[model samples]
Target: MQKLDRAWLDRHPLPSPAIGGDKNARGRVLVVGGAEFVPGALRLTGEAVLRAGAGKLQMATVRAAAMSLAVLMPEAAMIALPADDDGEIASGAIELLGERLANCDTLVLGPGMSASERTEQLVAALLRGASAGQTIVLDAAALTCAGNLGTLVAAHEGRVIMTPHYGEMAYLTGIDAETIANDPVAAAERVAEKFNAIVVLKGARTVLAGAGEEAALFEGGSAGLATSGSGDVLAGVIGGIAARGAVPFTAAGWGVFIHGAAGEHAAKEIAEIGFLARDLLPAIPKLIANFGAG
Candidate 1:
């Protein structure tokens, strides 16, 4: 492998100049996840997309959660769906979700989703419908929900970007946590090829791979980001980038950089052990400023 240089990174910049365009033209990103038990996903994800520069972000979640998220995140559009007793989505919701999904340019799945049969069915349908023009990013619970991702990969015409922590990586890739922890780049690249999906293996140093390229490792962020809602925020960032017309690999690169930058800021005020996902909010603006987006 050749040594990575500064010029290599200078190549991957942010979105092209924003010409006169409609909000939908900027990008409409749909995030599919959240449950009765998990309201954090909806709020964090929606906010992250906005912070990452997406023009529109729509979150499809259980009705109750959607209501809560709407109140918490006024900027994010919420689509409510009926759910089971445990707040898990039911099959009936799929049809309603499908209608709205047709308008979305990108998808961000499994932030705070609960594993219900209905949720699984919804994911499968999205994968089937995902075409070359549309971009998709998978994270958190969605990684394990399918267990076998072959169908999703085979179904999607465009590329799929899957982000997994070490444990989730092991579960999805059938590798052990210890091995993934040691050689995350190699592990991410290997499994990405097997599934034929772009992989963003998350950790202290995030690794991205796709389009015949082997790997791009980004070391950014602080341990303070080890909070619950942080991953959801990261997913939103990538989804937002996708909505902005950036491809999967470029979005992942920016997402990884910004996610860590937010965490880095959050760590200054709070200890790494106790920092929460919300802590990264203020940091997000500062981070984006670094990108000259603000």
Candidate 2:
């Protein structure tokens, strides 16, 4: 892992006018996640993506959850997935996702998903179908499911962003959190190089890694972001920025800052524990503007 310090982030803020005067100019994000019991992941992701500046946000989820989410999250244009007997997405969901990905600039996968057979099928197909320049932010389960990290990178280089906390990172790399905690950059770079995608090793200081560039650590935010669905929100934020056509490392950096700053602001009124993951929504605009990242 490459050594990185805070100075690098102070130099590279996210670009402004995220999009031009047209709809296509602003990026579209397709978020694929949600199951019978965890449909909220899709809703949280869709909301977070839009809050972070994705012009158009689509939610692809099992048909069982579509109606509830459509009503709860009106902002998200929902794509109803074909489900199997267990109410989980079936292989047929891949076709629906493929159709959506054809029009989207990015994919945020595995937010509230279970390790169902069909879910695995759809995720595998996505890893196979994803191409260069199209960003894929794999969080939670999807990150772990792609067991053979090298093949994932070979499938699409510089297109994957794996957001893993200590446990997931330990599980994926066979390194304990203590070892990784002492040297997160090294762990981040090892996995990033293994998969050929930038890795956002989420923690006290988020580290970003990609091709050729030495890693950069973004230090900010608070424990308020350490909630249940916060990781899902982070994935959506990264996907939203990716929709803007920013490079993987830059996008991850911006996302880390945006989310952390949002958490910090949201905590002021909502109390660190009082505020939920979704509460970070209202803080996004000001956080973006205040950071001079615009």
Candidate 3:
């Protein structure tokens, strides 16, 4: 395992384009997940992606949450997927979603989605339909939606990045939270190898692991990051970077480090006790600037 530090940042700097290129030169990201009850999750993630420097952003969410989310984030193009009685996106919306995803460089799936049969179906379909080059960042409810995660991921030709907290990690791998917490690197590695995807095992110190790559450990976040919606923001940061052309592994490593830095900055400014997830959004650009992307 490698320690994620300034040295690593120097080795793998963030992606940057020449000054003359247009917005599309940076990247395009599509975020697809939001339920009636927690519609704010996708909004938070979308805004974070823009703040992280994605050139274009699109949000596809349930019908009930569409208007408010569009109003909340006018910068993103919003697509309202048909919803079921519970206002969760319907499985039938997959056809339309697949069409929209064709143009996007990165897909951020499952933020604030309900863990229902419908949701699982939608996630499975989306995974099956994703293009070979699309970068998929699966988080929150999507982690629980994959019934045969290994088979599903292996079938897909695209790069898949899975972000799971200890509880979610336990659910995905059938490994107890206690065991994962004790040795997160091994747990993350197991998941990565099984799924043929990059795994971001989120915690106080996040672990980034992939099938054939060295595991990377990031170690500088604060208690403020324990707040709700934080992981969604991290997903956005990673998705945004991936949209900008960083490979899945690079994006995950950089995202973890940037997120931890932003959390620490937010905590320092507002004190660890009261910082919100949104507070970390604005801190992202500054951290990226300091890192000096190339």
Tell me the number of clashing residue pairs for each predicted model: 1, 0, 0
Give a tens-digit lDDT track for model 3, residues 125-235.
Answer: 888788888899999888778745568776654399999999999998998999999999999999888888999999988899988889988888898899899999999
For model 1 the local lDDT of residue 234 reads 88
Better of 1 and 3 by TM-score: 3
lDDT of 1 by residue, 117-198 (tens): 6666777877776666788888876766656657667455336888888888898778899988888878887877777778
lDDT (tens digit, per residue) of candidate 2 on 159-214: 78889898878977999999999998899888887778788899988888775667
The global C-alpha lDDT for each of the candidates, from Candidate 1 onward, is 0.76, 0.79, 0.87
| C-alpha TM-score for every candidate | 0.91, 0.91, 0.97
Measured with C-alpha atoms, the lDDT of residue 6 in candidate 1 is: 33
Q: What is the lDDT of residue 67 in candidate 1?
A: 78
Predicted model with the maximum TM-score: 3
Measured with C-alpha atoms, the lDDT of residue 204 in candidate 2 is: 82
